[model samples]
Target: MDHIEGEPCQDIEDCRLTDRHVQTLLNREADELARHFTGTFSPETVRDCVEDSYTHLAATARIRTHLPVLAARFARQRLEATAKNQGATMSDEPEVLFVCVHNAGRSQMAAALLDHHAAGRVTVRSAGSAPADTINPAVIEAMNEIGLDLTKEFPKPLTTEAVQAADVVITMGCGDACPIFPGKRYLDWQLDDPAGKDVDQVRPIRDEIDRRVRTLLDELVPSNA
Candidate 1:
């Protein structure tokens, strides 16, 4: 995963936080995560995941108020991926990861569409080489118009564990950023970036992604199978 150099605190409230305060919050989050991943991971591992997730998300976060919550969610995802990599959790469903430059537009759209179409038949994740602070508003609007909600979705940094856990890795435009591993299927979809575009402009891109997602779904989980 690419690291963006910066302090984690960017918002006004975040700027007011002391190092101790941030550490305390992270410790609390790690405790909760440790309980959730009890049998699968150790406390130290959980704490490290939490701290790393916080740093990754905090680097691009525009608001610090919800940093802990977001960090928890991100850490959980990474831990789950790590579990999959370590064979701690087994799944028959295919795991897919979508990567792009800024997880704000193309990658996010593809992930949501694939999840919707998969309907729990497949596991989906998305990340970026350089994540944005928030999801692209136009992408959100376009997805919403199709009955998919993305208001809670945020950009996530790409991670080695995420790639290692995935059975299929799709790259939108991040190009050479995604790490390659043997036996994993890789596909590059040349899609237009939705940043700075309005909802109308994003709709076509969303539809195209939907079409591609459906095609991929057929290959991964065929109707006959």
Candidate 2:
């Protein structure tokens, strides 16, 4: 229900996000996020996360109409990773995180394929070293061919908390962007970037990722065992 009432801001600088009206929306978002993480994170922590998320997205987002909703969603994902990193939440399932230069392509495909294969047996997350404003249309089409939907997914920035939360961190073509931490398993996957490719070109990349994802799932949650 959180929405801006007027015309969407054409530019990030033109958006008066500090105005009273927008402030009220942010306050509501903070309150909602605080309640959602009542036990694991403090209200102040949630507010900070919400504010930071908004600022991060606002820097790259072309439109400001759905900024509040996107910020809230981003904050929730961060808070979830934080909770897991801090041991405030515990799960038996292994956590996996995929990283690439732009979350628009390879990482997205890998994460989705892994999630589909793992089902409820693993927790999957994907991020980018330098995230794109939107997902690659060709990548979305490529995934759709196999019945996987990427319409609701957005390119998310890579955060240290996300890496810390995952038991296995898979890096595609992001190089040394991801932070190295002790007690974590890191794997570098040499995959082609799908930034400018068409659906046909992306299909082979998608299939390769799918094959690798299935192999990873087997290792993580071996069905034969």
Candidate 3:
């Protein structure tokens, strides 16, 4: 069995995470998260958003190691989404949703690379048919080498709203579970799963995702646009 330090479980019997404990986790991540949302939020406001995000995720998480980081990422995504919606910038870009079985490995990597390469010209979202408790550590390590941070990213449950809102939907492994709507382009990527793989194993998958993302971006957003 794997060992965990300072496990977030208050009562081993019920394994329910307390609000105070969750806040402690959020507190540890607030300052760092502020750097990512500098103009959009203050440290205190980022903490509030992270706290809310942590609370929502803790309700469904089965593992605790990745909780704090995931909360920060989700909060950032929420903040960005809200800002784009209010500023009317959402209409200027194509929204893409990536789906996989766990939303922890392939989907996460693909979304991160796409977001990085697009540089605000594309809106990216990722979810899982069955979300995992935490993202794969190996996947995190692989992305870290390329200066991409996955520490704040979490596996989110797939929602109909996400599929409907996307201009393009890419499935790494998740199948029929992804909803199909008219006027949306769909692509299925047959890539190797990164779950349980070491950093070396994940590197190739990361590289492949980067390649595919660049191709997809070229098709969606022209250089002149």
The lDDT per prediction is 0.89, 0.86, 0.80
Tens digit of per-residue lDDT, candidate 3, span 1-225: 222334433333333335467567778788888887787677888788787766556655767667788777777776665555456234767999999998999999999999999999888999999777789999999999999999877788776657776789999888799988899899999999998789999999999999999999999998886
Candidate 2 lDDT at 216 equals 91
Tell me which of candidates 1 and 2 scores higher on lDDT: 1
lDDT winner: 1
RMSD of 3: 5.8
Model 2 vs truth, CA RMSD: 3.9
After superposing candidate 1 on the true structure, give the runs of residues whose Cα lies further than 4 Å from its correct spot: 1-18
Question: For residues 1-225, what per-residue lDDT tens digits would candidate 2 score against the true structure?
Answer: 233434433454544356676567877999998998998898999988887787677666656667777888989999999888777898999999999997999999999999988878999999999887789999999999999999888888899999999999999989899999999999999988888889999999999999999989989999975
TM-score against truth, every candidate: 0.91, 0.90, 0.69
Least accurate 10 contiguous residues by lDDT in model 3? 1-10
List the candidate 2 regions with Cα displacement exceeding 4 Å: 1-19
Model 1 C-alpha lDDT per residue in residues 91-203, reported as the tens digit of each score: 99999999999999999999999999999999999999989998989898889999999999999999999999999999998979999999999999999999899999999
Q: Candidate 1 vs. truth: CA RMSD?
A: 4.2
Clashing pairs in 2: none
* Candidate with more favorable, higher TM-score: 1 or 2: 1
